[model samples]
Target chain A: MSHSSPASSEISFVQHHDDGTFKKTVRKVTIILSVVTIIELLCGLAIFKLGHGSHMAVLMIKGLVTILSLAKAFYITSYFMHLGDEIRNFIMTIIVPLLLFVWFIAAFLIDGSSWRELKNTAAGSKPATEQVEKAVAPGDKK
Target chain B: MSSAAIPAGTKWWSGGKSPFNLSYGKMMMWYFLMSDAFTFGAFLIAYGTTRFSANYWPDPNHVFDSAPFIHGGAPLVFVSIMTFILIVSSVTMVLAVHEGHNMNRKGVEKYMLWTILGGLAFLGCQAWEWTHLLTGDNPVLVNGEIVEMATTVKVNPWGEVVPGMMHNGHQVTTPGPVAFGGFFFGITGFHGFHVLSGVVINIIMYIKTRLGHFDQRGHYEMIEKAGLYWHFVDLVWVFVFLCFYLI
Candidate 1:
């Protein structure tokens, strides 16, 4: 608190220095986001037209759109949130914990399917053994 | 400016300077956003699990096949407008932060106003959608009887259409999974709340800029922090758009 020249001292400590491409980078990212969203919407339309009977095609398009949304998320966080410009350690601090989501999602989805199987078996609507054979494609069952 | 004068052997962890070279406020804000991300992630994952368990979930295309004024069908059209609004608002927010970096108070204020307006516009769109879902009547057959239903937490009228069933000139349908309406309203309402708060924060930042508070302080880090929150809101919308509208 007693240090002199606080302005000069504080200025150098700032991390996101202007490298003369700040505006250009922002514009590029904006275009990228818009394009990615357009592609995602188009993929959505494709899935809608494919209808539920063509389950494989709908799933593939949904996967593509999910990847596209992730790309949009990357641009938003890396550029808009300035996370990309932060120190490496700081970036890791935000990212490392996020890795937990992988297991969180996987476990929940598997458990949900397991619960459905349990309900089917308890009801005796379908034997457990036959369910395995039928489970190959929910589409076929539908 | 002593960053350049430090010797090679200087221990970054042994000094008063931040090892991350970030202000405490900014670092805390980043961590807060990280936690918030998990919250939304959990909500979405739960919704996914429920969907996976159900044999027949309502198709988003069929469920969202109407717009504000176009009575019949415009699949993915209105929601795209909302997504576009959010993306443009995020761009304006980053511009506001950029202006803040340059200490240009006028630029910051201008961009902040646009961001606030965009946020409000999104909220308005959400309000209209929820109202439509709550009030629009759709006839469905529940246990072999024709009944009028609106999408709500305990009820869903978007089930598969039954063959040879028609009521009041509308196609009669079976009842949909109740969890559908629950998750839809739960996740989206939470997201809309975040957008509302983001606008509030942007408003405060705008007032600060207008009052020259940041100018007197010699920096606009406040605007940058608020921008971070605003962009996080937009980022969440990207995923929401994916889960709810697109897929």
Candidate 2:
């Protein structure tokens, strides 16, 4: 029941008792996040406003935007969500599985495109065979 | 009689409070969020694969060209604003959690209110964007006919016009459109639902804070928990913004 005890102190919600430090940390994080977001927006605009560049250039810009956005995601998750302050193992517990999930996506996307090609080929051949059959069939004369 | 059974030392599996230094509720929330991330990942991946397979996919710049109040070809201006709003809201949410840590009820209340307002404003922006999308002219040209592109499960205004498939003997749509529209609606709609729910939760927490609920309970873990959820919503939006608007 004593607030002075170590166990009771651990249970308290406020981690850093210094009010100034907490406020400053929050303010710093907000500024960093805003700056990163603005950069992403500018990069996005540059891609189109610059007249699509080349096909390869456009792809490069798109890739850059994705990376900037991922940076934004990192800041929000680490600082805003307090993941940075959490234990190392805890962070890995969330991140390792997410990386695996990304791998899952890459694998499946490759498979999907292959299937699409197969389907397109099958559809192309099927109609041609039907047209040939129509000319040869005796019932078509009726 | 049970001295050995109690474990001689503080092993890693020692039964106690927050072995990982996280509250049980917070840990559970993290697990829930991880699972939720997978669901969103699947939706985005589906969109990516579908786009890759298509011969002609709608350019995001041309598709999302309209901004509120400043008409005439401003690509992603509106979505950029929405992203800023969500990120700002996330900042407020973190500040609220920080205040909660200090046991400052007034600080928590003030910041929470701001966070809730940010969420509502973001939703408003989304509604405007959706309206523009549904009602605005389809950017893609098809046989000199103006086809109004709207989000539909059956038709895709973004894809090439399909031939021979008809509703009442008129050719309806192309095969590419369905996947575009489907993923667009499915992923964004799911994220919107989460935002809506986050708003509701924030309001509930706001009311409780006003009523001195945490003060009575002697801790503000509830606010921290709610903060986690709000931040997750913002985090998810970053990806949604990339998939739909920027990319």
Candidate 3:
């Protein structure tokens, strides 16, 4: 058991004091994450301001935001969360569920096409507003 | 030199350390973080799908508008403060872990209390935000039109629906798609729940530390575990910020 253990004084998940690199890694990435976040916020503001109700602009903003978020997540998992130093098998175990989760999202997004069809259906053609107003007006009859 | 003896009833791969060892606590923290990761991932993914699939999703700025507050006309200042609070808590957590390494019980308690306070404040802000969402905007705007009916007008200032309105978009006098409300409630609500649980765990650890439990054991694995979970909370917030605030 002792042989299997890295060392009584060894750092397994993080290697900061041994070479003092871990703090640098976390600091560097945290700065990066903060910068990216600021940029995304600016982009979000610009899209809302300059895009002028353009659907494509909305998509662009959403895409940029998601990309920046993924960057931060990657840094956290690799550094702050210390998955980068984990064994390949352990990393893969984490990766598998995440990949599956992405697949599930893809499936749902595809399924959401059904929503478009619903939007075009006779029932959905009516504005959500009119329906509510009508429903309330009738209820008021009582 | 004698090899260290593995504790009884423990698997060879139980980190080859006692279940009560610092290493074991670290591993357990990883497993718990993994589960938490899945939960947050699911929420973000679902939010993505909803945003993408919707015919006309409200702009994030419109959804989260900054408005002037009564105090010095401060508008939407809390979000910025919330971000900083979370970051400070993260810093305090690192300090706590550092103290744990030195086996400084009082230092651990001090930082732990600060971290727990930060967490509570975050939760309180979340609750206020939720109430604002539910009560302020009944018929928030989605596209250029209103979905639900509210007593007051809501505006979208970032040219989302139209400039110069509330952040959740202009509150129109129409009913919104229930699906929109459902996703909003589910995703943010779920993240808030995680924060709540994290706060509770930290509180318990704070009490135990105050009682000198870790000092007696000659280790501060609980502090490390708490640090792991606290870091995970910050990790997930980064994602939520992107999905809800930026995107």
Q: Which of the numbered candidates is closest to the native, going by highest DockQ?
A: 1
Residue-wise C-alpha lDDT for candidate 3, range B1-247, written one tens digit per residue: 1122333564434454432223655666777788878777776666666655566655555555643253212322556566667766876776676666667788889999999999998888877766666555344455565555422223321222334555453323323334565666677677778778888989998898899997777667677677878878887777777666665
Instruction: Give per-residue CA lDDT, model 1, range A40-60, as digits (tens).
Output: 989988988888779888888
Superpose all Cα atoms of candidate 1 onto the true structure and report the RMSD in Å to 1 decimal: 8.0
DockQ of each: 0.29, 0.26, 0.17
| Fraction of the true interface contacts (Cα pairs closer than 8 Å across chains) found in each model | 0.52, 0.40, 0.26
Which ranges in model 1 have alpha carbons more than 4 Å from their true place?
A1-12, A16-20, A122-142, B1-10
User: For candidate 2, what TM-score does chain B get against the true chain B?
Assistant: 0.85
Best by lDDT: 1
* lDDT of each residue in B111-229, candidate 2, tens digit only: 99999999999999988877776765443335754455565665656565455444433334432456766787788889999999999999999999999998787777888889988
> Please, what is the whole-model Cα lDDT of each candidate in the order they appear?
0.85, 0.75, 0.64
- Measured on C-alpha atoms, candidate 1 has an lDDT of 0.85
Model 2 lDDT per residue over A99-136, tens place? 97668877877877875686578674475554553355
Q: What is the TM-score of chain A alone in each candidate?
A: 0.74, 0.66, 0.69
TM-scores across all candidates?
0.90, 0.82, 0.72
Cα lDDT of model 1 by residue, B138-229, tens digit:
99897888889999999999898899878877889998999999999999999999999999999999998999998788778888889899
True contacts kept of 2: 0.40
